[model samples]
Target chain A: MPRPLTIEPNEKTILYTINLKTLFPVRRTLTEIFTRAPRRYVHAVDGISFMIEDGDIFGLAGESGCGKTTTGKTILRLVNPTSGVIGYRPRKQLLDAWRDMGYEPPIIDKFGSIDIAKIPGKYLKPLRREMQMIFQDPYGAFNPRYTVYQILEEPLIIHGIGETREERIDLVAKALEAVKLTPPEEFMHRHPHMLSGGQRQRVGIARALILRPRFIVADEPVSMLDVSIRAEILELMVEVKQRYNLTYLFITHDLAVSRYITNKIAIMYLGRIVEMGDTRRVLDNPLHPYTKALIEAVPDPDPKNRFRIREIPIKGEVPSAIDLPPGCRFHPRCIAFDQHPEIRKYCRTIEPPLIEVEKNHYVSCWLYGTPDEVMKLIKK
Target chain B: MSEVLMRVEGLKTYFYTARGIVKAVDNVSFTLNRGEVLGLAGESGCGKSTTAYSIIRLVPPPGRIVGGRIVFEGQDILKMSSEEYRRKIRWKKISMIFQGAMNALNPVLSIGDQMAEVFMIHKGMSKKEALEESAKLLSMVGIDPKRLRSYPHELSGGMKQRVMIAMALALNPPLVIADEPTTALDVVVQAQVMNVLKKLQKEYKVSIILITHDLSLIAEIADKVAIMYAGKIVEFGTAEHIYLNPQHPYTRGLLASIPRIRGEIKKLEWIPGIPPDLVAPPRGCRFHPRCKYKFEPCDKEEPPMVEVEPGHYVACWLYAKR
Candidate 1:
């Protein structure tokens, strides 16, 4: 029998990496500094937060440029945060020591969550293995000049996974099997050029899994794959998750993919998580206007259900992250606003906080009431 | 029945790659009625685009059309001389809005100049007259004619798409082949672009072959749909018929895999395995490996496409008795 799954508490989250209010701004530094006062930065990723369970699939979903990818990279210390807490519960206790030795992280957090402006860069490397990322474009991610074997081996040699050549080769084979790239010998000697798109993606997954990392940040890994092959890839991910007992921060624009794989889903807007909750709850009955719009936008394959249509409140382009309006970021395109006028005054003036609406469902929209009000409702 | 504006029978487009002849479009056959939208949907390298290219005879080498007939407006396009094909059919009789065709626009030229070039080439219109007509086409696709002065890069992805539509309609062709017209745009923009296509279809009465990887988009706009896999149409039916009751295993797998906006379901079912390599495609049924109901006959001989209901065609072993 399979072991029962249980979510570990945040207290036990030793490597708890918190990205509090990470903001990244587009730097027009060269043009602005010379002529006039520096321009205000684009608030790409406004303040966003979520706890990463040790072995859970933490889904980050939103439209393109909603700061999901930025949040993933910042956790790995790839991009510097603007101003917020990125507290990590590291397995290795040397992070603080490295920091004290003056290994500060980066700055001008336009879209970054924290004030990386305050941190330096030296302490980000050793912790990279704890947090790895799989990018969206399979063709673009794999090194073309190198063969498939070389691409898989490059990471192992860099991370010092194995000493001898045979041990490294064995690790590659295991990784291939995990991704169902069967009979590793068939794939070992070939270049990425010989493989199909699905195979290349499997090779990518194999490469990421070869490191035996605990947490992986996958950004739209299967979005480019064919529908016929998507299941194969997704099934491989599910199988690997169980086999390795790993934690994942799955990032994607497609909510359907998240629905199929993730336990919990977080919906983001221009730069903030508008709604997040249990996958079934969020996908089945979305709370925020933006979430509703996104859900409604996805076309159902069942043609008979075409008559039953959900209303999309927001339409048109996502507003520029820079020079954002001082209110609820979605007010401009919100359809629910017309029915609920009370949402206007404060919703446009004050930024809504992510408050728990139900036991597990968390919403940032003001309509569900403030944290205190929600708590009162819960108590009542 | 509707008069067939474009009919392609047994179309075969092959690419002579180093490894082998990739049978990109093999024995493909379909008909597009005047003032109708026929969606050609499948995954990447499914030959949806190759079918479109073959219809227009833009088959780029090392790709060549070895056989089949393409009849546009009851005229055998295959028999037309290269010059005749160019002069009469290329843009005037039938037009195309290719995937990422937004990039097809010249960066150096204004939207006005680009649209005008289509008119100048096809109609042999003078430069002055072509510019005037370009503005009308732009307005038809919901873009402001004044913005025609803007460069391709200046316009948003959606606007550039609208410009492509405008260019495709410049000569008022009876047929327009739109391959993945709005794949790159956001959902909102995708909706708007699709709306524009529907609106233009109504206005101009031009038949459209809307080819895309998205089945849902096909559901929303396409009146009829052809589900292609490994260069052949496994199933062809009305959008309502195909989406509601997919007879083919491949079609069912596609519908099951997509995540729906409404309803609470346990989990989205994913189709296992990949499409067989076209260079050496599976012997009997291409989808036999992934099909849940595969029998011995499915492994040995290809199932012929049979009509299960009015206008609904499915090629599968389960439906072989039909």
Candidate 2:
């Protein structure tokens, strides 16, 4: 009665997707909604689309409540998406075995792509082994009752990875060593309270690494730690990525940290990516007005720039996510919207699609022209 | 030279815990000229905030200003009676915009009512007069005076911080101590708040002690910079001197660690090891354990503050002879 879903191999991208939207409904009575109705839906992750290559450190950066965390959580299936598709391509070994079996994988499309968005809870359990998340607050993430050893051991036990108790302990110790919490025996018995902020974060990383997932989403990993210690943690992350052959979806509000670690970065504004490209290209030559404003707003450490009054290009605070402006979400606060009255009608009426303005660089702004015309505009 | 507004000499504020005495602010000294912004930069637990609290005499319990003098406007704050200090000096002369002070505002009370209380208590103004003054203060910080009736929760983070600034200046205090005023705010909002602070400093000519861990933020507002390490000021100098040519190893390490927006994306040279335990600080020099240029003398004897260049002072053995 039902058509079977199937997947075939297309060996280029690790994950590809179309419009991905995650909307949250605000509880309101029917009478209230019928009367002075405020926004019913909060667009937490609004129609965002991006792909992560294998082993690429993809950064998603935005201010607080901009849905950077939501995007990451959605990918890890921590929060289910409302609509759209997420095409996840597993490792070659899994693909080859599935092809040999001559079976159509449930939730997989015709082209060897598992639709992460459509996968039910029961099926998601196996997929969770390949994707894991490291939370923002290390203090909150861990169970206070569990010791460091027990905490790291929990993941391995849940996944049923190790053959015996001794094997699990060995794996836990190795994970701790991988995160550079040296002399694993010394830290094993200690509780979360016993560890410093940096040490606690390392334990969180160790717990995530214990799963040996292919893709890891690190949400504001270093923001909670001291500035001096942030670099060490970032360096550790890089080392672990190389050693484990892992891909990362690094999320942070601070661009400086993003620039330091990420290979590719996507700048989000009000739940949408405004600009996405290689870290160097995006930071050096930002196309979106929001991107330009954010870079300028960062306080330059050089004292020569002190007392030099540079006008802040944007105006007003980020608007409520629920009541986002009609077309361009940034239009209300955009400096360019005020300057270019000719394009104001277009900007206010139609949402701009992400366009490749340069090689591997994408920007979503009406000023840059439409998605189809963007390439020609750049050429001209 | 400008007139000195405040002079802190050998300011020692320590916390007496069960473990040991945490020497939070040990033998810290600096002078703030009138209308000049002096930035207090340090890592967490480095006692930068403690130093600010010591000046205001707001150090929490278990922590006490054990010794040293905090001379503000030629009067030793430590020597002053509690009653006298409260009446004459505290908010009337020196007000503090505390760390995370945006959330410090009373939630139930309107912004106008809370701000007015400062005027009512200090200036002994009527409710009506205080509210009017509060509205004026709100306008000064670029917030709509009409929103003075709104509660703290009603306003955004940036606006709440601006309200804190306005409240700090309500009594027209000549010296304001802002502890990480913009740390929790977004970068764009941070710039806005910084601009407001800069404008207030220029317009009202109030000396500010801006305490934050961010070096870039310090560069923006501070005329003079003091880099704290393990409860002691390792480096103290003009902002230009500190940024251009740092003398202390810790200061240099901090500068190098910060990833710049428009520079070559090289690996950040992070300082190895954590900040020393305040309860049992490292012997001789607290920073010697992590200092890259540590020598035999560094471990045996504490280095005294030496003037390397006219205005710049660094407490390190490497600069002792210079």
Candidate 3:
């Protein structure tokens, strides 16, 4: 009999465990090299570990400069990681190449994933077909001079998807229709400047979809758009996701948008996820103090809760990310210090590990004890 | 409702651009009462910022306030000489917290120097006195007094925004126009900065014209809201009126489109098309092409502002026919 599978059914498909660390050294002077100066890094992304099942829109939501963008870029190896593992289980065919390489990688589930970090530079090119990125700025992403057809067809040409020019044009038309820019011929001839902001973004989405990749990383795709048009793009994204069966790592600073689109969410503060779980569950019942403040700060449109002057939950401005606070990264600005004085010393000294307080929810706060201890406390 | 601090009657600001005349602020009108927070909410090119520029007489070169009666403090300030306006009215009477003003601070000058310069130039305060006043202003906006000595680069984005707020309040101009003050700041810091603005509005009794694209943010602190579309105030009403019962179709669409943090995830209703070009706007209603309720008169003739209910006005054919 086969060994009973421990992992979830969805886990057998895709899971990414990213832990990128120690980034950049702009200028290395001869004097500094001789003196052996201790290298200082931005720590753009520091030891964040989270996994989502196949077809999950895992949202990396946070404020600007919180390393959410870096996390997405690192996963695609857009920026080479100094030290980390980017584990991914591509659909079917890539497994043969893994075995052919004569590398015995550890299997997370029945469908063993290859460590993208371990994969050599040359081998990584093939994986580009498996993953793609939808950039934020539609205006800057495309060649202003290139027609919509040419822009979409370039990816197909580079990836060598079609045999002839006619086949590529047909493929481009199909891609345009998928994004709802109907009568593809009408849009095909127009340059990037001719399209509206919303339409331009739709073209951007079409370019990403033209590749037909399994995983996509959308970085604030709607932030630059007008309020009236964001919904249209979001709807297109959802429609395409269903049609293509694509999993997305949606990155944004807007939590409301995350709640609207993503199924799962991880709220990053500075360079770490303070809280993460099911989007609705985590947003409704946020566990971390930082998460609580983020929820409170979201500008709600309704007038029922008017005139509260929503208090600034966190104490002061965010501390410099270079030399972060010693213990818990959030302790300095954390309102929990006033609410729970008992954990102040612990919060000051030790960095707490992510503990599963609920079935699916995980939080890294000292206020919550171990699983057994928390269960006993709940029972009482 | 207390006292009419400023009345902008039939304000017509037009830009003589090479690409045809751009009606940036075409026949707009609104009033800002004493200590009132009026939110000028609109999408891009809807002319909220241009209206603000017109108020301060800082309408950029190509654009000029063609025809308007700005009755501020019982005086039609448009009739005042440019020299008189600069000496008494502009900056001294009504200041402005410009768009992206957070990064607009002088990089070389200390926060104190920039802030003290406002006092020294406007209020004729000595350097020693101005520096002392600058410290007090900084603290008022919730920045530490010690940061006054630091340059712009030393301060965080939030702190820089607070410094701008402090400098705006330095001359104690009764009216201040903040154009997208918290546009770039994060939510947590935005809330903090909003708290500072709210405190100033309440305790200090300063009248603020909060201009932003965000309706929810406007709903937070605005006493009244003026929704603009294609350089016209499509809807004008109290914050409650606009939020609870929006009159214009554009207002309703805008409200419905924004995803709520605390509510049912209803299907967002997009306005369907981009805003009309200011150069050559649509024939009658600028929003008619995108409007779901575009009827006979909407495409033919422009509709005048009709008082829908007490203190609520809407410029739409649906209301006009009634």
Candidate 4:
């Protein structure tokens, strides 16, 4: 059996150096499958790196098929990465438990961080309590056969939490109450179908929190919900984050939703992150051409601004990920490509490195220039 | 500009289900102008989609347009026979971008073949002439005419939706009904698609009835707005009047609930509880259970729609003159 997993207290500075190469064989003939021939690499998540400090809500904002969901799944090791380090500070609950028995886990570094990506398959069980995920579709996420009670209890049963079945039932009841599903008894026996969209999402959140995880990846948590219920669910998520001191990696395509919750935000294009910085700084003053197009593309609700019936900044839909452009992935659709003829060659041929264009604001674009030849082409 | 294009009065659509009759669209009344866009905004199962289906005379199996008059131009559409309506009205005068465009297109047929089918049947054109028209339509929607040979499966979701838009405008229908055209698309692509519709609406002088659950999208493109609640239109007015000075409790709740990209971070006030079941709806106001300002009259007796201002009409006890 694998050694019992335990670690030190989670405080600050959790680094993630994630480099993934996810390729799916397309247009394969019968003979190709038998021969095991390579077609083309999709490169869903190319070389990408970012840090999520403790208690941070990092927003991954992008359009469809941009690999935001893939990035989240990769961090949790739901999808194995070819290479990279996912350094995580273990659950504080386990630290206290391990301390009482007088033991120290050898895996922890000086910063008390563990590379979760390196952990083998069977050993991932203990780490489930440290991190969790909330899927986009509440309807399809849960098992149809399971009741609210069974849904919440299965995680506890897998991890061997709570001494008896009665104890687990009490824990489940508390989890329900925590999500404000009042009088816990009212919802425990109900199936997912009986509950409305909002109520079902509340149970999704409850299931995630029951593990007492320090981190949670909420993938479009409120997208499937109605507008009125969307806000209510967001409020609940915020309250839970504060009450439990949990960090969240909020993934969504809605910029307004991201603006509300995330402190730090990353704008992704195709697969690579085009821009990353403080949420307000990045959204309010977007740098990358892709980011600007995305921001302008977001349909504003303000009736005072109905003149939004302008031409779409970007030319067309994202091209095939497998047949990526040579230099900048977004050069074909970038408005700056036409504006700056001086850097047109570089924009089309040489991929620009993600460099700090401003304090805490990192951008990858030829317009921003290299670290040595830094130049701001389009200024605010 | 003041010309009234279509007027719907006391429209009632009911579904005779095994459980009971579900009054999907109950007494919904509105006017569509000649070349303006009207937004029908509501939550799911609130009967906004039903109203559109009723107008198109395609309210699926159990649902039927029980009582109402859809006066288009001058003549009442309900008075016309199914055969006459099919030959004259449908696709010739008014067309619809179905709610699910992804599933609307034929999988086996090429984009050109499907688009050409519209022209060949409706306009009595040859296959060659229809294909040429299809190419032109594709060009108008910003898709390459070369993609005509490609099947529906070959195109992206946005491209598939654009194909649907092209088909809707094939005959240059004077009026188009888009039921959540951008519902499942990415915001960027959604914005692009809406822009395409807006551009065409101006170029062809066609009025559009855009039915959607997103209020923000409505604010961007709609000339007039109608807020629906549990099978009833709770509020109706010009987009400016409705957004600037909303009177109905449900409307106010909806406006406040949306988080804005360009505004001060204010607390979103969401409406409490779920919408009532249309089969056995609340005796009075459908939204009475969720409205914070609901009083005795709100739940006891149904409130008649009253004109609070010049053009804005609201159905609520607060707006009703005693």
Which number leads on DockQ?
A: 2
Q: Residue B111's C-alpha lDDT in candidate 2?
A: 92
In terms of lDDT, the poorest run of 10 residues in model 3 chain A is A1-10
What CAPRI class is candidate 4? medium
Full-model lDDT for every candidate: 0.78, 0.87, 0.85, 0.86
Best by TM-score: 2
Off by over 4 Å in 1: A1-9, A12-31, A92-120, A304-311, A337-343, A370-380, B123-136, B266-271, B289-292
Error of 4 at A89 (Å): 0.9
Cα deviation at A368, candidate 1, in Å, is 3.9
Go through the candidates in order and give each one's DockQ: 0.46, 0.73, 0.71, 0.71
Write the residue-wise lDDT of candidate 4 on A1-380 in tens digits: 01111122345755455444444446877888899976767777776777787778999989989988988998888988766667777766755655555544455567777777777676676777888999999999999899999999999999889999999999999999999998888899999999999999999999999989989999999999998789999999999999999999999999998998889998888888889889999998999888888888787666754555755567766988889999998988888898889898888887776777677788888776642363232221
**Candidate 2: which pairs clash?**
A6-A109, A7-A112, A8-A111, A8-A112
Task: Give per-residue CA lDDT, model 1, range A71-173, as digits (tens).
Answer: 7777676777776666544443344544666654442223222232244565455555656788888899987888777888998888677899999888888
lDDT winner, 2 or 4: 2
Cα RMSD, each candidate: 5.5, 4.3, 3.7, 5.1
Which candidate, 2 or 4, has the higher DockQ?
Answer: 2
TM-score of every candidate: 0.88, 0.95, 0.94, 0.94
Q: How far is candidate 3 from the true structure (C-alpha RMSD, Å)?
A: 3.7
- Candidate 4 chain A has its poorest 10 consecutive residues by lDDT at A1-10
Superposed model 2: Cα runs more than 4 Å off: A1-10, A33-39, A92-104, A107-111, A370-380
Cα lDDT tens digits for candidate 4, B114-142: 99999999889999999999999999999
- Per-model TM-score (chain A alone): 0.85, 0.90, 0.89, 0.89
